[model samples]
Target: MNPVKNMRREDMGLQWLAIGLFCCFVILAGGLWYVQIVSFKKYEKYREVQSYRTVRIPAPRGLIYDRDAQLLADNEPNLNIVVYLDQLREDFTRTYHDLKGDKDLPYLEGLELEKDARYLTVSNMVYEASVIIGKPSALVRSEFESHYYRHRYMAMPVLTGLSREQMARFMEQGSRLKGFDLEVRSKRRYPNGSLAAHLLGYMRPRQRTSNEEAATLQMSFDYELPDFMGKYGLEGQYEDELSGEPGAKSILVNNMIYRQEEEEWLPLLPGKHLYLTLDTDIQKAAEDALRYLNPNQQRRGAIVVMDCNNGDVLALASAPTFDPNIFTGFLPASVFKPMIDPKGSLPLFNRATYGRYHPGSIFKIMIGLAGLESRIIDPEVEFFGQGYFPMRGRRIDDTAGAGYFNFERAFYKSSNAYFIHYGLKLGPETIVDYGNQIFLGKETGLLPAQETGGYFPSKQTVRKGWHPGDTANLSIGQGKIDVTPLQMAVMTSAVANGGTVFWPRIVAGWESMMPNGASVFEPEPEGRIRGRLRASPQSIEILQKAMLADVENRNGSGSICRIPGYLIGGKTGTAETSFKNSNGRRIKHTWF
Candidate 1:
């Protein structure tokens, strides 16, 4: 009688079970959709945090060329042998197993065994690399452990700056040296060694930037590759342009901090090429001449040559120049000791721009111009000389013969007595007027922060001091004025270019190099004039004639530089310095 009722109850129970199963399927599908489509980015970022390491990579440095397109400063490939820790993961585990042989250890001992295993594995590979390169093991246990803990994703260098023989040896058996590989990087090179060293400057190895604020506030890094920074001259002046922009890369790693793969995060832009206005041939000649003139090789002096028409510096040379290559890395004490000579011949000092000395008779040209502009000096008029001029109860001596000297004869013979007489008549105000026109007391702007604004007495100072002896010293270009060879070159250029003083030019331009070996140039306008002289053309012409006579006449002090048929012009002087040298000797600055 209850059979029909039981069958109905069973059917109801089956219906309830099917409905419950359907509800469970719906909840699972909704949860899958929310996780797969909505929260994907959040989990992806979490994965990256645990597995990826970011590294800062330095860009290649710019190439430096001379006026002739010859490389003055360059970059050459340096090959190194290193062991990639990532590739040694298997060896580390196998070595740990081997070291733990036949015993189970405590947790602390086991951790140290893992450490020993890692160092032993890396050290063994380093020994293999040392054998191949014929060098000692560069690996240290403590350093290896520290690196393994912190930067296990990076490669460790085993043999660096490989010599040609070492490189050859490695190449012969590199394939069998598992986990060790060769990496080529660029390094600064000066092919001519000390040639144009001061002008070209040197670089220092830097791992990070000098923007301390940015480094502290914005820039963060776990690791970085070494880069170079310019320290002086043209290299230093254009640091931003030469170093270019830095980039970054991402290292995909496992839980063991071993790199599995790598991907470039930001592409690096290469630096521009710099072209200088200097002529290498002229620079070499000037340097050779300076070396030749100083037979003892201890002279501390400088030379500057310029293009009178446009103010382009053709050559600039400084004695006791250093080989800039030594500065790229750790400077050895032996090489550095010789550079700091006891005689005050510092190789790092750039004398062409930084040296200051009494201009002596080279200042006579400005004095003559002042006299001519004042209408007190007539080129053809003759004056009597007693071999010295009397002033301030003192006599300024002259090398010229005591005789009647017309302006031409006086100038050609460097008649200090004649010029001093006229210079006194023109007075300090008129003389300073001419000096200002020639920019005698100002920096030439050839090298910023490195050039000196040489000393020239101002009218205010002269008026305050007002000593007749000072005026007498000022007359013959002796007491109060100082200058650099670069300044003299500029002053001489003003005379040669008919009184248009110019700002000396050094760097010519910069260019971007293309991958296909072609260059895209960015030209800088040349021959920028600093100022124009107030003297007339006739005055300049007269002064030029006098300078020519100085070189042409045998009685002239500058006659030593005279070459027949070329009509070369010059002035010579030996000036007394107020300071004593390091060896307690009085110094004199001699000039041409």
Candidate 2:
């Protein structure tokens, strides 16, 4: 045989083997490269789905301050012991034995009793927590399960509203605890609980925001953080300024359950401080006056005080008001029944700016101006009113005994018959002309959706088959006329300020944090000149003198509203409401 040819064959076989090995290596290397680099993002995304969770740490809510820099609504620190469900994975698996069994375990387990075997595993952890934190572990098991299923990323609040001592104890022992963390969150608190409930309003739970980013962010549903939304009053009217933009926080929670660190994506902006036109001292005085006026507190009424010169609402008070703090969610329903339900009463109702009533004699002021300007009635001329006027075969009586009356005497006595006769002479056209010019029958157009527009019959409205009877009814503020206390205040203000009607200002301004970490704020007010009285200044002087006589004269009806040092000119109103009596018979609801 040829030894040289055999050696050549062996060498050729070795070469072929080496080539096959090289090809295998190349295939393996390509697969490793795809898994490690080319498709790395896809695999990493899958791992994140199972292992990583992004948590939303709520930004501290903005604070509310008054004009004097006094805190109206502020935030308080709330200590809560929270558990990350992602950390309880192994324990939950061990306890259930079968993840599928978790669905049925809740039904079989007795939620009230701590002795049930089904709850033993979860209870063991809870009981240990109770011993360490000094709280009862006999909580409803359903709460823990619901939190686990619904909100896995949000920290599970186990112990709520803990004291400072308890928080300190947990923080000290947190190193040994596997899944427990002490969370510091802000809660809304009003230092003066009921002081300005109506003006300041109360905080409510976070509303469902439509923003896609808001849904991506997370917060505990079980426990309330101070994400208060204004429900009524100025808080609601100026909600955007009071509820400044919420800041963003990223909580880095590791696999072990403890929060590793936290960073602010956007630093929390403090809510803009509001400086109101309301004078706190004057507000207190008005409130005291209202309570004093109705010592029994049985009368449902309201009082409003304003700056006639500047259009600033100094104070506004309503009867049967509730503490706005109660609306914040600490009290049970039972405690709030009488106030919330009120049976036939409405404690939460803001009667001052919201309640609509007949202006009574207050309407006479506008009527007098209308008649005097239209030349239908002369202020100097005398009318013989025999305490009543016969209209459409029905006689209407005057509260003030009528006689030969000049304009000044008629206004002082509030002679309904005289005003009614003259009002009819001017007709609904002139009356409504003046009324609409004064912006009556419409809102003052200040804060949107707050005050009523107050109604008055228009000429166009009356021309559409309207009756003379309707004009007779409206001559003395009856039939279709309805006015809010704010409307009355504004009406009176126009008269006091010589015919320039201004919007009533409530909320002052907003306080907010700037990009440079400095606080920025501005004033907000609604001001406008609605109209000028078309009457001669002599007519105004005649009415003004009569109004003064109504307050200062011995026979004046407005003596009750007078202050010793200040000249207060006001008119009284006694309205009739539709209500049922004790005998199941209908009767008039009286208002003073």
Best by TM-score: 1
TM-score of each: 0.88, 0.82
Compose the digit string of candidate 1's lDDT tens values, residues 1-592.
6999999999999999999999999999999988889988877655654667877787898999999998898898888897888787788889999999989899999998998898888788788878877888658777777877899899876678888888888989877867888888788998989888988888987755457734653565567776788878888888779987777788887666878788887767788889999999999998988888777866777999999999999999999788898887678888878676665579888889988888777788888888887789987889999998877677778878699998888877778888888888888888888888878889988898578988988889877867767766777778888888999999999999898998999889999977788989998888787899998999999999888878887878788888877978877777878778779987888887
lDDT of 1: 0.84
Tens digit of per-residue lDDT, candidate 2, span 74-116:
7788778776656655665465554344354464353322223
Worst 10 residues of 1 by lDDT: 213-222
**Stretch of 10 with least lDDT, candidate 2:** 217-226
Error of 1 at 394 (Å): 3.2
Model 2 regions more than 4 Å off: 1-12, 15-58, 86-137, 165-177, 211-226, 249-268, 295-298, 330-343, 580-592
